[model samples]
Target: MLIKECKGFELEKEKSNTSEDFFNRSEVTFIENGEEKTLHVLYVRYFDEILQEFTPYSQDPILADQGLDVTFKDIVALVCLLKNPGLRGRKRLYINSKHDFAAYFQDIDFSKLPEVFQSLKQKNSYELRSPLEFILQPK
Candidate 1:
């Protein structure tokens, strides 16, 4: 019954986090209610515009679920990125699976995304390396 805003949350991607035990053991620090708290955010959800709802691919979002990885920031970003043309149009970016690319695309610059994705276009059944793959990939 409590909803609060996260002031900001930044992951230092360049540095490998030894604490990250894959997704199951990852955690992030964020600001909420004027105080800092670390939450275990791990669930994946996609925005369903047709149904006008949020579809959770994981367990239900409840405080009792200590292992749940879902977070408001992640859900918001996924919805925002899916709304952009860069991730959806002709110069589309194909994610082999959710594990390949998740909600991180929303944090990147949308204006430059379309251009970067152009390099990813496949040729003769072999996909080319994209500058975006390095950029958008989650650490």
Candidate 2:
């Protein structure tokens, strides 16, 4: 499926130049179950102490054969934010089925990302109220 629109946000106001940890906050809209649904996605790159390298991560589970064809084990990381009626002015952010607010590294094909994401390095945050095409599947 193709993401019809994508908008990004930066969680942190102050960035540390020395720190290698960074993450992308984006809202992706796609057609699901014959209706349009928007998913909040977070693609993170963090410094791994044990590996001594920057690792990619997401705080949510990538369900296989559901939204995308990829399996959970095939990913580097994922996070999904959903609305919770009980929480006031707060959304539930899931790091996967097992953990909440926890993060782990996952591998994602950088080539498949949209140009908006590719240009993220130049600007830390951006909000574009326009239509954009982002393909998750490899062409």
Candidate 3:
């Protein structure tokens, strides 16, 4: 059976590489089927001169599936979680062709992700660490 959704997500911001222009890099841990699986996430931010605020240019998920247990539904859930719907115009979420979803995203069923996200969000124990705490904590 496919792993349709995770129990929850943990976003721990990773240290930025000075050579890269990324806004935030995170180690996103997905609590799925009583196991903690992780994926690397990178976000590119562009300063909007008119809005006077930083906005996401793109978001990417790096899944090293060598020994990792993940599914296409997890990819859908990840996309639904990371893709900022609040953005007005262009699509900023990017997933490379290596992952399973990259090849069959259009064909895959994504109906269950929304409900999973709602359930995950409503849980009181879920917490995302601040940047400061991320820096202080050992990897």
* Cα-lDDT of candidate 1: 0.30
RMSD of 1: 18.4
lDDT of 3 by residue, 1-139 (tens): 1122342223244555453543323333444446554444333322111111111112222222333333222343344333422221222333333342233233223343334344444552233222122122244
Error of 1 at 127 (Å): 40
Model 1 Cα lDDT, one tens digit per residue, 21-139: 22221232333345543333332223212112223233322112333333333333223333342432122232323533444433443343223223222211112133343234466
Show where candidate 1 strays beyond 4 Å: 1-23, 43-101, 107-139
Off-target runs (Cα >4 Å) in candidate 3 are 1-17, 22-27, 32-35, 43-101, 124-139
lDDT of each: 0.30, 0.32, 0.32
Ranking by lDDT: 2, 3, 1
At residue 67, candidate 3 shows an lDDT of 35
Candidate 3 local Cα displacement, residue 119, angstroms? 0.6
Candidate numbers sorted by TM-score from highest down = 2, 3, 1
Candidate 2 lDDT by residue in tens digits, 58-132: 322222222333322222221122122122123223232222223222222333333333333234322322222
Which structure is stronger by TM-score: 2 or 3?
A: 2
Model 3, C-alpha of 26: deviation from truth (Å): 6.1
